[model samples]
Target: MSSIANTDEPAAATAQGHGHSASTLTLAVGAVGVVFGDIGTSPLYAFRETFAAHHGAIGITPDAEHIHGVLSLVFWSMMMVVTVKYVLTIMRADNKGEGGSLALLALIRRASDNRRWTAPLILLGVFATALFYGDSMITPAISVLSATEGLQYIVPGFKPWIVPTAVAILFGLFAIQSRGSGKVGKLFGPIMLTYFGMLATLGVMHLSANPAIILETINPINALRFFQADGFTAFIALGSVVLAVTGAEALYADMGHFGRKPIGLSWLTFVFPALMLNYMGQGAMILSASSPAAAAALVKDPFFLMIPDLVRVPVIILALLATIIASQAVISGAFSLTQQAIQLGFIPRMEIRHTSASAAGQIYIPTINWGLMVMVILLVLFFQSSTNLAAAYGIAVTGAMFIDTLLLAAVLFSLWRWPVWKALPLVAAFLIVDVAYFGANLIKVPQGGWVPLLIGFVIFTLLTTWSRGRELMRASMSESALPIEIFAKSAQNSATRVAGTAVFMASTNTGVPSALLHNIKHNKVLHERILILTVAVQDVPYLESIERYSCKDLGNGFYRVTIRCGFLEETDVPALLRTLDLCGAPFDMMHTSFFLSRQTLLASAKPGMAIWREKLFAWMLRNAASAMEFFRLPTNRVVELGSQVEI
Candidate 1:
């Protein structure tokens, strides 16, 4: 892939006279809407369950001092991991407006032109991406179930209906994906705004009642008490506390949609403070109450407990709205991840149907949509409660966080060229926090954590095998490519006698493509007018439309056409041809036949790879849907030419 274009601040900064005003506030709120869904909703269950979940065999006494200690850890974890590490520092390390594992890889690749660290960086990027898959699957299940569990709190008799209702709501959500979210996205901001307001109001009200020095939980000393009392239990608490910062990655990933300034300000000014206050309020509630069962009572309906009886209905409505917005964020994230996977060549191209005419990123992939729906339904059925889903959640989030630290360290050392002394300490701090969370979550493997790890490992193996197989196939084919001059000199004479035009798809521009070669060697025919086309998939999330396509005419009735698409956009050959006015390319497509080269990987022990990987690649290649259907081409006009590749 060619280097991704960087056109953010540095370029603008150099052009001093014309300045662009960065709206720090707007981007931050939008980022909050997009990024905060996962972590923001965690307050509904994080604390209550940490003390009561199956993982915590020895539940902490739900007393004032103990509650303060746990809440303190939650607050500090958010400050250190989300606020200090990600918001204050990591967001500044973005590649132009793009951020994520892949974006970081491109930045490091650009800096280290020597390719010495390419393998490690790319592997880390792919591994981080695989972990994201695990996170996406759980976010929906946990967020919605947690919010819906409030039903039992309002009316004790509704306990049995909570699971069924949550499942039905999730089903409807997935079913509407094909219709697109543009219609509903307009209301997400409004709904989330109200929810945040409600949380802030309830927190302030609770804080007013306990006006004594209870606010002292903000001090670092009290947080130290939890560890001193029980070090092993407190260490395990890091994994659950880390959940408070789950969505920080989205701050960087969604930076392009809304600029850096807005996202940063939103977290610092509004979202962060509101979250801290609500958590503190929960701590206060735990401290002041005189019953051992108070925590359990509040857990059933904590958000409503702060609201009076008359306003409970409004609060319930607000919480439901917030849950919908939260689910929407994760659904959109899944779409983005699928596009990135395709661009990086881990997964074969799928039919990415665009939903909005104006928004290039608004896409609908049927395969991914249906796949996630099935898995989420199964999760709702098996786990049956948010408390159960929580056990499965930390594994994915912490694993991804750990991988992010590893890649970020590579970026600091190799890309930014930071000195060893400065870089090592920063790297060590992140890794220590990340590893602690990862190890803590490991204890839940048999309970629920094994699901994501198993899925991630399976996906990672396929990704590595396919990427390596593609490399071997290219190396072997490059050795066999016929010289362009010799092919033009010999085959240019009396190739065939078709009427209007024929286009043959080739992976490389120089060689006579596999399809054309097969047509010439067996049928002894070509076309009166011929064109060879190569489509290059780019790594960036968005591409400039004006420079979206380029074509060159090779002499002797052949033309080389290359089309570029952002990782966020799908390539439609027919649509591209119509726009470029080159269906026939000095010849017309109304009378053209398009030839596509299809590769079938066969199991081999000939030494290209370990025998195990060869078998794995063969299985994936067989299972992948055909290119003709994937790209949404005209069935009658398309023809596939087959070739075998041994890997």
Candidate 2:
């Protein structure tokens, strides 16, 4: 197996400045829009779901004490999960400047030296990524559905159109993805900013009427009393309480886009305050209602109930736009994650289209986009309501969060090198909360939670199969490969020499590429100058241009070149070759012949993998993007040599 050593040094500081300047404020505003959308929209259904007795779990009483208890739980859950765990702790464990389950996994692996522990950590990371796919699908379905359900409040007669309207909105959102997010992304910050402002305003307006509710909410005693008084019911209520922090991971995952400072500032100064006020406002509204039944009905749609009737229509319109923005963030995240997976060798390459010339991160993946659209649409159709979809929501997120806790423990003791005393308490707190939430969500599996779990499991299988398959394929190829020294010694005397350059793509630096061997054997000639090129994706997000390529000259007109890139970088062989100084001169497309190997995988009774998995891997390999396109080789000058391999 090939492994890249992880660097212990901190990632080079980001070039994007986050100093106390106007640029920093601008980035912070942008961060508010993209980073907090999912959690920001939680007020729509989180409160309502907590009291929903349909699951035979928790019963809601609109008395002051019960209202205070639920509000305290929501407030504390956000503080613990979103603020303490994500904002303060996990975000600090970035890989270079990138944050995500995979990125964190890379960072931890780089820091640890124990080979025995690598497999389990990788499995944890892959499962976390798989769970993210489930979250990506559910976020859009639930966000848009919850936002559109507002139509029922505005016009009771329009209730029947909720599902259809949500479907139309979601379809439209996915349809425009191919064109790219650059154009629409400009408005996300402003729209979300306005949405949060509205949220805080509505909450403050209601909070002013019942000021005592805010005090009760801030006190931790109410939350303790809630668990003590209700016992098992309170524990079940945690399943719904988790909804308030559903999108907390996005804050950390998106840290690479906006630096930690901007994201952290945005969360503390704006997102956190706004979400608290809104949840508090809903609680206050419920407590101040005329009757228990009225409070119950009001909580069903408390987000809209808090808005004044005069501005109800505009608020619903704003809510729909906000949900769309939230959905956009999740969709874009999926694209970014898929690209990372491909670069890290967890999945096969797919066609990646850059939507914006200036932004390297702005990309569109058609397969993921369309696949997500289908799954999201089906989720909407199946659940038929945001409340129903809520049943399926927490499992994927909590599963991922649970995985993150495990990964974080590795980072704490292994990577960060925190002494056991300090790290243990922090890890324990995170684990306790993560496990509590995950265990609570497990109760929902029979109802609808199985959807995300099944999706995660299937995706996890595909990821592992592809990863293992690639490793086995490489081993098989290596077994047959000729050493560069041995090949050069024999070929110099045996083959006829021709003019011009021939570059053969190789998976490893030590072996002769199959394409090179095939060309010399069949064509009976060798280029005067031959280059065996190998591309390596490092664990980091990017490598500096000055440190990109290394070349070694071998006798008999052969040169071995290795190009290194970070996981977030695009690997364009042609582009990197243009900057090459050590390999004769800079490459000229007309003079260069790019030779690629197209492997035809066959499912054999090999010990490497199950026959079914081998077939699945073969199918994925067959459908992957062609090397000529992926490596940006000149189409007319490229030649593909086909070969069969069994694993």
Candidate 3:
């Protein structure tokens, strides 16, 4: 604790900047594929759900006024929620070229300089991340089902195979996660480009055929009239309309992967136009129908039905591929967020495998991959259709969006110190939009909206428990810490000095590590050169290599080393050790032995946590992947010393 300083500004990593080596245009293309995938695929179902959500619970007649109004809502929802809040405003609040709830939280934490008020903000960020898991599971389920449902148009018998086909597609999607997103993203970029091209082409064809509604769809007055004419019904319809902008928050979340400019550029210059065009096309196609029956039939599934009969099958196949790409993006995002959670101590350390040598952000976590696969399959099986799963969507996305607004307020007002006049109006607009969407979605609780809320609660509990448990565990561990100076001097005279250098891993730099203490007490031997090492994960995404480690001499062949790395960077202790020439010589694998302390947690009624939560913490501790593996230590040279901690 003494060695660790609460710095207001962290030496953030440049990995993201390094990743920008590709031209911005190239990056924008990649962003089109991955960052916009979730939102891009919304056209497959957003329009259909808007007219006929909850089994016609929000059935609005597709007349000229209503058609223009729904189109207005979809267009403006994208404008306000996606372009205004996220692209123009919130994306500016990046943490060293990274953006997301956690990234934003870390930014605010540093900006606040460890103020107590940031605690609530931290919880909000963690809860938003928790809700992301629900989104991660639902996105794949709904996207796949919606795209595959187009099968019913090709072959009426395809209705029965819809769920099973979705399930199989989902299985294969998750199965391929280990292969990494880099190659897949390159492949996806071109396909998604083609998909968006198709979207714009279809929309333009309809837009020209019925140019009557084109001007009306973009008018704010039309959107307002929908609320005025329909009132509560329009509000209820908002729950479905929000499906149109479902991936708005995720676009901000994924800023780290592609940088803000590329994602923002792709959204504005490409994805946004394509999506709006498609929505307008759907609306124009439905509105200009020859009769009411024809309009209603178009309303059923305008996305596929509007496609020319000849190209419909190819478009369906393309839509399926696009949906798979969408699922991959969400799945990859979960992996990246999990890495941040582990580094920030919100979740226990798990095995994180790097999938690409060039991209540091590209990673794969087996536990998360498998857990998401199981949940998605169950959701597809239970819901049985995209419409049912649609009932469970939007809520999580809205809840997370609202949380981001609160976090953004902190950034605008406190971090950036924007004036009252400037920040107030901006925040108020965000709140009104966020509250409206969140409130509309809340009305869907009984209709399966509870699924995401339940998932968020469970995940929030787990994240908080692990965080609190670690605090208590560290407090308990630190109480018995002996100073390194005292231990080094005393051990020098008492223990027989061995030949090789020994590295003791300590969670806190202030303490003589438990493993070091146990070793001397039992074996009564010490390495000629002893290094007490602490690897600190900073809040930023990357750190400069020159500022990587700090070495302090404790005399008597003793040295203290602290390695500082950004949370988003993977730590390889062995590789880091190779770069350190702490005591007149570079660390060699042949002469180095690594020591690790493994804690056995005892869940006691000790007032620190609830009994059940304590047990959960203990279970998590036991199941957490080993420090040896997480730190990428050589298994052959590592020694594990067990110690018990009661909290």
Clashes within 3 Å, all models in order: 6, 0, 3
List the candidate 1 regions with Cα displacement exceeding 4 Å: 1-26, 211-215, 292-301, 497-499, 543-554, 574-588, 610-612, 623-625, 629-636
Highest-scoring model, TM-score:
3
What order do you get sorting by lDDT, best first? 3, 2, 1
Q: What C-alpha lDDT, on a 0 to 100 scale, does residue 440 get in candidate 2? A: 89
* Residue 610 accuracy (lDDT) in model 3: 92
Q: What do the candidate models score in CA lDDT, each in turn?
A: 0.71, 0.87, 0.88
Total backbone clashes of candidate 1, pairs 3 or more residues apart or in separate chains: 6
Which pairs clash inside model 3? 12-542, 13-542, 13-543
What TM-score do all the candidates reach, one by one?
A: 0.90, 0.96, 0.97
Model 2 alpha-carbon miss at residue 531, Å: 0.9
**Residues 179-198 of candidate 2: C-alpha lDDT, one tens digit per residue:** 99998999999999999999
So what's the TM-score on candidate 1?
A: 0.90
Compose the digit string of candidate 3's lDDT tens values, residues 544-613: 7888888999999899998887878778888988888766688888889999888888888787889899
How far is 135's C-alpha from truth in model 3 (Å)?
A: 0.4
Worst 10-residue lDDT window for candidate 1 reads 1-10
Q: Please report, as a residue range, the 10-residue window in candidate 3 with the lowest summed lDDT.
A: 1-10
